[model samples]
Target: MKLYPIESGNFKLDGGAMFGVVPKSLWHRTNPADANNMIDIAARCLLIEDGNRLILIDTGMGDKQSDKFLGYYYLWGNDTIDKSLKKYGFHRDDITDVFMTHLHFDHCGGSVQWNKDRTGYEPAFKNALFWSNKDHWLWATQPNNREKASFLKENILPMEESGQLNFVSLPETEILKNSELGFDIFFANGHTDKQMIPIITYKDMKICFMADLLPTAGHLPLPYVMGYDTRPLLTLDEKEAFLNLAANDNFYLFLEHDAHNEIITVQHTEKGVRLKDVYSCSDLF
Candidate 1:
């Protein structure tokens, strides 16, 4: 198995929203904000090449939203899925699976694109099976008022309409071992309903796709949950348990939203679990 870091794009978001109730004085130290109080964010997706199956985890924010809509996020950078795939000598058509951690526009938006005629939207990866769980699929499709803005219909629906959508079976326990995607899935709910965090084994080390469960190394603190999370209290519990496990087992966390820090590991400290080390994608994959 081979892993490639796919740089979809970069954008800036309000630091306050990203760090929730955490005081700017604290979070700003790690994730410094610009003059506009916006911090750099990355839609760093992951690509897995195992045998003939080329699986992509998250597609970033596609270039389909109107300028007005995209402007709100302060989009930056020249990275695109096409350019990143080409860097690895691959293309979207070579992807066999597009596994979405959640249906948020920034995570799965690139899964759909405007057709050649620009008449309607269509699946971005023509040959890929778009993956989501039944719970998250329903949660995103029938979104609540708070999350409605993040779940854009143009970024979704087309996968199912194209007859390429598939759902991973929900696990009875916190972790689902040996999933259909050839990895273990850690189910988390605090961020959103049934957010699936992929736990992959490579070279005898577990590389966990940290999704929103732990957006960045700065979010290692249990109470440093995102304001966007529906259940912030529940997020505290999930992070505590997951961080403990990650520290104990020495798991390499693959952060998807951290623009600067690519991969990191945590260790037990007097202040609880804290960042132990940082690594570039090349160090592991």
Candidate 2:
């Protein structure tokens, strides 16, 4: 199986929100903020080339939102899904599955696009079966007040409307033992309800897609959690357990929102799980 890092785009998010209660004096040393106090973030997606299935994990925010809405995030960079796909000699149509980690707009917005007539939305990858777990699907569709802004309807709904939406069925409490794809699935709450983190076996190493579970290497510290998470305390517990497992097994974390660092590994340090080494995804292969 081959894995390609899809560079959808970059955007800025408030550093304070990204690092939760971690003081600016601490987080800023790693994720230095701009003059506006926003830090650079990447909507980096992953493409899996396995057999007849071309699975894409997370579609970055599409260009369908209004300028006003886009302005809030301060979108940056020319990298796009189309350009990224082309770099690998592929096209959006080649994607057979879109495995969404969650339904946040920045993560799944590229799933749908404005139709040619501009009358309504349509599946961005018409032939793809868009995947989301049942719990996350419900959580996003019927979002609570705190998360409503992040779960934009325009980024969702169209997949179901196009008859291409499907769910991965697993016990709410367990990791998916029977993955149809070639990856083991790790379910994480805290960040959001039932966010599926894919543990992919690529080459001789295992790579876990760190979708908000661990946004960047800077987030390796247990106390450094995102403020956006509904259950920050739950996130704390989840991160501790996950990091311990990751450090023991030496799993490479494929970061979704880290702009500079693409992949990272953690070590069991005296201070707790701490960043070990960083690399570009290609460096692994």
Candidate 3:
């Protein structure tokens, strides 16, 4: 199996929103904010090349939002979905599966695009079987008012309309057994309901798509939950339990939003599992 980091580009969000109730004086030292208090974040996706199944983890913030909407996030980057895929000798059409971590725009925006002549929204990868549990689908489609703006209909619906949407069984409360691919699913609610974190085994090492659970090294602290979370307290509980297991088993956290750091380790420190080191994903291979 081969893995590639698909650079879906970067966007900005209020640092306060990203780091939650943490004071600026505290988080600024870790992930510095711009003069406007907006912080740069990457929409990093993972591509799995296993047999004929080319699975893409998440789509980046697509270029479909209006200019005013783009102004808010300050989306700036040269690397795009197609460009990133081309780097690995693949194309959008080659993708066979799109495993949406959740329906948040930044995570799944690139899943669909405006049709030719700007007719209507359509599946970005027409051939890929887009995967999301029924629960997440319902949550995103009928989003709560608090998160309605982030769950843009233009980025969703088209997957089902394209007739390629599928749902994986929810993992049991107990640590899930690996699928045939030798990877287990870790569910966490801090970020979203039933968000699935793929625990992949490769080359005698374990790697997990940390998703929003541990977005970056700066987010290692138990108090660093994002203010954007619907249930910040629930995020706290979920993060602590997940981090403890990750530190104990020495898993490589494959960060989905960290632009500078790709993989990180957590040491069982007095303050709980603190980030031990940062390395590129290539180091894992």
Error of 2 at 80 (Å): 0.2
Compared with the true structure, what per-residue lDDT tens digits does model 2 show for residues 1-285? Answer: 889999999999999999999999999999999999999999999999999999999999999999998999998889999999999999999999999999999999999999999999999998899999888989999999999999998888998888999998765564776586667898988999999999998878988999999998889888999999999999999999999999999999999999999999889988999989999988985
RMSD for each model, in Å, please? Answer: 0.6, 0.9, 1.4
The residue-by-residue lDDT of candidate 1 on 52-107, one tens digit each, is: 99999999989999999899999988999999999999989999999999999999
Candidate 2's C-alpha lDDT? 0.92
Off by over 4 Å in 3: 180-182
Candidate 1 error regions (>4 Å): none
After aligning candidate 3 to the native by TM-score, how far in Å is the CA of 221 from where it should be? 0.8
- By the lDDT metric, which is better: model 1 or model 3? 1
TM-score of each: 0.99, 0.98, 0.96
The window of 10 residues in a row where model 1 has the poorest summed lDDT is: 215-224
Candidate 3: tens digits of C-alpha lDDT, residues 69-110: 888888887989999999989999999999887888889999
Quick one: ranking by lDDT, best first?
1, 2, 3
Give the per-residue Cα lDDT of candidate 3 at 78: 94
Number of colliding residue pairs in each model: 0, 0, 1
Residue 36 of model 2 has an lDDT of 99
